[model samples]
Target: LPQTIVDTVVTTWRLEIRFLWIGSQCIIQDDNHDKVIEISCMPQIYGNACLTILASRSSSVTEGFLHERVISNDILCAKLAVKVFDQTAKIAHLIPQRKNVELEPLYRRAWALQERLLSSRKLSFGSLQTRWFCREMDDNTSLKDDSRDGWTFRERKGWEELERFELLGHWIKIDSQTADELSTQWYFLIDTYTSCEMTFEGDRLPAISAIAQRLAPRLGDYHAGLWGRNLLSQLMWTRVNKSKLAKDATPSWTWATAVGHCRYTDNDLTIPAATMLAMLAMTAATAFPTKISGAASAVTLGMSVTATAQAMETVTPCFILATLRCWFTLLKY
Candidate 1:
């Protein structure tokens, strides 16, 4: 009945619908004594779109059966997927909502929602009303047609629409930028998902790759570069998944640490940002405590990394030039 459960289900259900639509085979494996569910098809699913569903389902369910499969691989995948899908769906559909929509109160509304979800406290009506309107505006600033001339009313409507568009645009920009920035990083994580190498002490590499890809496509360019790197860094120091790292030794954190060590900040110009990060990622795979030897597949793997880094470097100066032109255009606007 709770909003959290409802939201969880809606999100999870959508992913389930997507996976089912794609005919994905979900596999749940027990690694390091914990049950790890891996949902994949021939191409495999990437990003966090499926996570809310799986995590919510896993948290909310007791019984887990959907489509029955006689084949072992299909059976395992189906069972895991069904269990995860159902539980999360149940949780997502029970969230509550307010009757009135507040204009231009985005962050404040979000804060209130978070407080209500995390703590059992409801926001004060007076506070909500005050926050709903801008401080300079009055609560009685009737959205009604009688108060203003036709032109003024039309202008207000246009401004409101523009504000909403800008908000949505900003969100889209930040999200897409992040994914673009971290695309290669997620690719690295996906390729070396089972590795044990790491830089920080306690990090969750699986989640890093999983969510980073999903998040990147929706972020703005500048913010994406900032957060994608931070998210990679967080995965590097994760201690909870340490046991998994010990067994695999090709931990995702290795890249995190390596990238951190060889960072191409404004202060340091030994290597360009694109080149340094690319090299750090490739180098970390081999030099870490685990020594995973990702280079072993030089013809297949090493070549890709090498080519990608080279390509990014070759194209970067041009990218920067294009970006500056766009910045100037926006400033002129």
Candidate 2:
């Protein structure tokens, strides 16, 4: 590198940002494919990871702001990630500390929830000592004593507890936050989940299919990423960085369509679900029934490519009208 060129780049443009760079994009671009089509390839578990000591900058990147590690690599973690219910807590206290606890780095990383849920057994390295959790353990972590709930693990009831957990637990991450705020749940889920590195951007939907499937029966229809119920409110996603866009990753209408990070950062600017519902109620109150356009009635699959409906928030007639008008309006422009 010449001194003159280096100085010019530094002065003209701000940062020569560098990090882990995989050449899949470069390989594809040399041939110039219009779209990076997602292929269907399912693995045994949700996904598999490779643990290797590659001589890479990411392997050595341990300083300042970018020091956080995702829980995907050493990704297997059992339940008891968050505060367990009181019933589980009381029983775990009665159980003895028969197993060893591994307290190293369990409480960090958002993806730990996925690893924790997927793995059959988990040895958590927490703040204090290492805690053990397995399919057969009565109690795992000393959560009662150490701010983590151990009751669910006690009584050797970990597996049945896990079945219920597998179906019910994942919702907690979304519920815990959205139940309180009620507006930005989908944005939170996307901001945390999509930021993760994947083998292909196409693998995004397949990786999270289980969660989507589980929620379908409960949340009605599922759109590409947003829920049908909360479609309009959730669709207000703005890219954090305009330069990086995932234009072909998804349809032009979805947040997933954009490449960079985005969010419904300003909910105040958006109309409330309650207001939308109220308008629907008012329209229905009139002599003429407000006809919900057929396209607006669904936010599911096989619809028009322009169809961008999905479910998320509370169910209501206004939801259809609100998001339908929004979709048509967006398509029009």
Candidate 3:
């Protein structure tokens, strides 16, 4: 373990936290089997924690986050002398703004994305100042307000909303409005997550597995990072830049197979008529094996109609077809 992390453990002890679960210290690094088990349990580990400590300033494990921060002149308030009723008085006004947490090295890591989202409470040791984040409230040592514009605030709101819906567990009762909100949040997550940097390309799926598991109850069946319920809309993702396909077993249809950042289409919530027909046809084809012959014909027709619709909508037809083919192939097994 790094000295900084060791010091943090001591700090936790001082705070009367009985136990601290450090990934490096707790998990067997060399054992892939153990790693897999631990990785899957990340949601529980983070979500259940009283508080999660983040070394936001540190670029690497070895670089300690405890170093003194350099504050700017603008942040420091200047004292002013005033005369009120012939009595001298001194006063100062300060407006301490919170630094952008997204710019931090820790926030840029792909694995930390889920960690931040899952943890109910977070104590971030940032470069400018330490900040605290929770579902209900956020505060910093500089006395920053919640009105700040930053990714942390936005993600916190998203997580809180997700928690609210998850607690209710009546998504079907609320209908499309609720489903659309959830779907929109999920796509936003994908947009943010794919933009993060990862050390190993293979860790893409494994790193996000915890998040997937966390959302499974609300989102339904997980199919290569895409939900089965919104499979058609989820398949409408496009790469931000020209990138190579993943050299792994990941399906080419899913964004996980792409090397670079991927973004979902604008109309993720609005399912077109052709897509609806295609989805229904595919669902019938897979759900009822006895009606395969009839359903397969419908599927073929649906696919053709979907391709035409996608082209008309200015979406990549080849991409949609590839996704449909891969989805069908997966359903076969």
Candidate 4:
């Protein structure tokens, strides 16, 4: 190769490399099957590890944001009690800039919701301060010292209620492993997950697929957005958008058909205590059946209403034909 040609090729290569993002958080995704898989895998990965959002991750942030993040990272009080034999120059004790620093821009993105929830431990640098959250904590607050700088830490009111509820459930040994229990848990998770926004409409299913994968083994089977084993019960979902019809992206029966939040708040997970006896009696013999038919996985009524009337060809054959035509026409949407 000519020397000039080699130099030009090297320069072009460097520019091409510059075009490709090599940042720590860059995600390479496109409109393909692999993109779906990548989106679906995110929840599982986050669920297994910690969700750490730091100031360093915010490349687009200004110097002011960085200064605030640095201030928040400073610990005014020691995390653990210590006995110091030698006293060196002590670190300056600066008060917290704010309780919650502005959350990084990444946190505002819709895709960050699952990552925040599923992570085992999450470290966030807000505009006001930095905080650490874990599944073990009753609340997400990492700092609980009001005694240090006369900073009184008033606990969130909701935390007390949640703690009491969890304690009660623990005492009774709620069936956390049973199918019924799984259903209740999934209901709560889906309600929260769907409430979060998504940038791409196409990512609707793939984004939540990891949570589905985790529950698939215990949840029987997944059909569209509903469960196959509990098909009858799953039909309880309603269309949120009444004025406009649901999009064809997903089946109308599934909740994913509408872009809205969903909640199943009968106020209790278990059947009412008054009807507990009825729940116990719901054995296979009493279970309602469903029929699976057709190549397109259509479901039909387990027990069909069959009616037959011999056409009175001699009396009113034309009338009978017209009546049948009118009935069929009414069925069209």
Q: Ten consecutive residues with minimal summed lDDT in candidate 1?
A: 324-333
Better of 3 and 4 by lDDT: 3
Q: Residues 1-333, candidate 2: write the lDDT tens digits.
A: 333233323422443333212222323543323222211111113233221111111211132112233433332334454556543322223332222111212212222334444444443333222345444343333434433344343343442343333223344333343322322334555665565444345444544444454444455455566566656555666777672655343545556665555665532233333223211111121322122111111133333332334343653333223212232223121
Clash totals in order? 45, 29, 0, 9
Best by TM-score: 3
Runs off by more than 4 Å, candidate 4: 1-26, 54-110, 136-177, 241-248, 265-333
lDDT agreement with native, every candidate = 0.27, 0.37, 0.61, 0.42
TM-score of each: 0.24, 0.39, 0.67, 0.49
TM-score-superior candidate, 1 or 3: 3
Residues 12-114 of candidate 3 have per-residue lDDT tens digits of 9877999899888898988877887788789789989999988888888877787788765665454456777887764323333323445778868887877
Off by over 4 Å in 1: 1-25, 28-60, 63-204, 212-247, 251-333
Error of 2 at 202 (Å): 1.5
User: How well does candidate 2 match the true structure in TM-score terms?
Assistant: 0.39
Question: In candidate 3, which residue pairs clash?
Answer: none
In candidate 4, what are the lDDT values of residues 1-333, reduced to their tens digit?
A: 433233333433653533221112244554355454455565456655424333323424233223323444455644334446654334444443322222345443444544554556555544444455555653434555543323234433232233232222321232356766666555655565565566565455555665555566677666555555555455445533432323434545556655666644433233222111101112233233221110111132112112233323232211112111111111111
Rank by TM-score (best first): 3, 4, 2, 1
Any runs in candidate 2 off by more than 4 Å, and if so which?
1-113, 117-121, 124-184, 247-249, 270-333
- Whichever of 1 and 3 has more lDDT, that candidate is 3
How would you order the candidates by lDDT, starting with the best?
A: 3, 4, 2, 1
